[model samples]
Target: MHTGLHFISGLPRSGSALLAALLRQNPDVHAGITSPIGSLISMLLREMSQGNESAIFIDDTQRKAILRGVFDGYYGAISQTQTVFDTNRLWCAKLNVVAALFPNAKVVCCVRHLPWVLDSIERLTQQNRWELSKIFNFDPGGTVYSRVEGLVSSSGLVGFAYNALKQAMHSEESDRLLLVSYETLTREPQRALDAIYDFTGLPPFQHDFESVTLDANEFDARLGTPGLHKVGNAVRPNERQSILPPDLWRRFEVDSFWSEPAWNLRGVRIV
Candidate 1:
């Protein structure tokens, strides 16, 4: 009774959680809320790095249990006909590292405009107990947020993330994947959900579209002033404005080393 694995990945705040939450409403789908295996795997990597001698082994039953645990924790309890979904930001990267482990895994990569993505990240840093370095695993004293801000403002981070995404898309197992954009999903949610349903082989659910709209004030609160300041004007920019500040956008355009045809190849226009 092994349901196939489905992954929803994207840049931070690109609606991965929203998508997962929406998909969970479907009776035939069970999304993992907490993935113990992923957590364990992360801990195992940390242990190994610290020279700990703990051996992590996976057998068939254990694998099934881990998958089931992931399903129940994130999406809810699994049913007989349910397709399990694991929605996490870094899951795609982990999926790439262990592609062979799950033969029938399906990956969905979510994308958002670079400017908006950077803006969202910046906003989060300014509000609450924002710690960019801790989240990104950088030194506590390092200027990680500032550096990231520079990269995003200059559009360099977009290309880097896009390239990484492209590499994931081009894997030999690429057919079992789908690439989606946040703008499309936000604007035409029904259409986007329909596409996601088709891709994941799940039936559609009764979704609350109105409840999902992005809240400007709330978003700003989470992001803070400095983060909001950098990409504030770029939110849902018009075509002309999409050409962000020239110097920064040009970096990714000209860098051959960072470019990947499969990943960077533009699909449908999002905005």
Candidate 2:
């Protein structure tokens, strides 16, 4: 029973994927692209809730067991020898469940400036000119403005993740959360990794930032977005001019709440 578990979550287009790739270098750790366990847990919860006619037969204790078993069954074999770090944007929204199930688990959130996050996604969409992105429901028509609007809508990817992070920041479990800014992760990867190790209560291990590698071609292809999870051979800042219109870029300038110290009421650790 490998009880050592943690989570990797935060906004997309951040460095979650890259962090996972770098963490893979550690022989004692296990991490990868987002997994289906988050969705699976939701489905299981619904099935065991009052929505199900058979819910009367399942008790609270059994419910907890089933939920915990999902983690055990999914990663038990590999986690027996290595610490597990599950990746999912939904984890931030489910901190209450996390507390009940994995009380000691820490959540490492990869964050970035809101404008840059949107810019990265927009660049990916443009790169795949011939295909429709599942991010926008695979619709064939929409301008950059429209796409941006849709992505920041209440239920949109960026919007939802951003909102969930805010919710996590104010939760009682906020102390269990660690925010790793994309800039630091890229420009000062060693320091970022050191903070992460300290947060997760693990010993440090050497990581080859210069040779970090990841392949998500098949996954990105299915989503009609190429190189979405691609990582460079070296972990260094890739500064570039923003392709977004001036007005659009400026609109989200104030959205990176994590950058503002005043917004961190809970004093959640930020790297």
Candidate 3:
């Protein structure tokens, strides 16, 4: 067996938690709101393979076992029988590591346009205007320009995942990657789920759209974001207009790089 493991990753605020909540409705699948495993994986990758001279002593076998162990260690609480879906915004960047550890694993990536991704975060920050979300801690005093720049920088939230997803789209293991666009997920969820189920060879389960929910209050509050991972019991389109300044939103209006016809040849099956 291939460990019955998979991942949910891509842009934040792009319905990753909602997807997890819907999938968790499946009795045989164990899905959770965003997990820290991706951060842990990144830490291990740097420590074991990139940092100090001692990393030279860590061969591929040992590195693989250690990296793979992070999943076993964090998910040790779940019964081995349940199919697992780990969520992280960074997993798209680490497909190479995942391929090494779990060859059969697939990553269900949720992506949104860059302008909307920025708009979504801005809306949340404005909602909690009195407080600061830790997400912007690196640049607490940044204005809309700085914030957008930071977020779209090479290592920023959207840029890193965008580059990584593009890389994974072209990698030899491309077959194991599935892209679920935020628009498609919201407007046509059944089609999105169907594509996901078919991609991973998981028997399709009817997810109750109206009854889906995932409570992440404690975690969200700790990060000073009260509704960061909140999902409605029912999945619906977000008709809310961007609360960001019109100029800011307009500046990033052309953020949907994946929509280009040239990208169609990359072999990424976007739903």
Every candidate's CA RMSD: 6.8, 0.9, 2.0
TM-scores for the candidates:
0.62, 0.98, 0.92
Stretches of candidate 3 exceeding 4 Å from the true structure: 77-79, 138-140
Per-residue lDDT of candidate 3, residues 1-271 (tens digit): 2378999987777889889988888988889887888888778878986667899889988988888787888878574778899988677777777887888899998888878888888778768777787777734577777777877788877778778777777777777788898899888889999999998889988777778789999998888878999898788888887767888888878766667668756567888
User: Per-residue lDDT for 50-158 in model 2, tens only?
Assistant: 9999999999999999999999899978989999999999999999899899988999999999999999999989988888888999999989899999999878999
C-alpha-based local distance difference test score of model 1: 0.52
Candidate 1 colliding pairs: 31-75, 32-74, 32-75, 33-73, 33-74, 34-73, 122-227, 123-223, 124-223, 166-263
- What lDDT does each candidate get? 0.52, 0.93, 0.81
Model 1: runs farther than 4 Å from truth? 32-37, 45-81, 96-99, 127-145, 149-163, 213-271
lDDT (Cα, 0-100) at 213 in candidate 2: 85
Quote the positional error of residue 221 for candidate 1 in Å: 12
Ranking by TM-score: 2, 3, 1
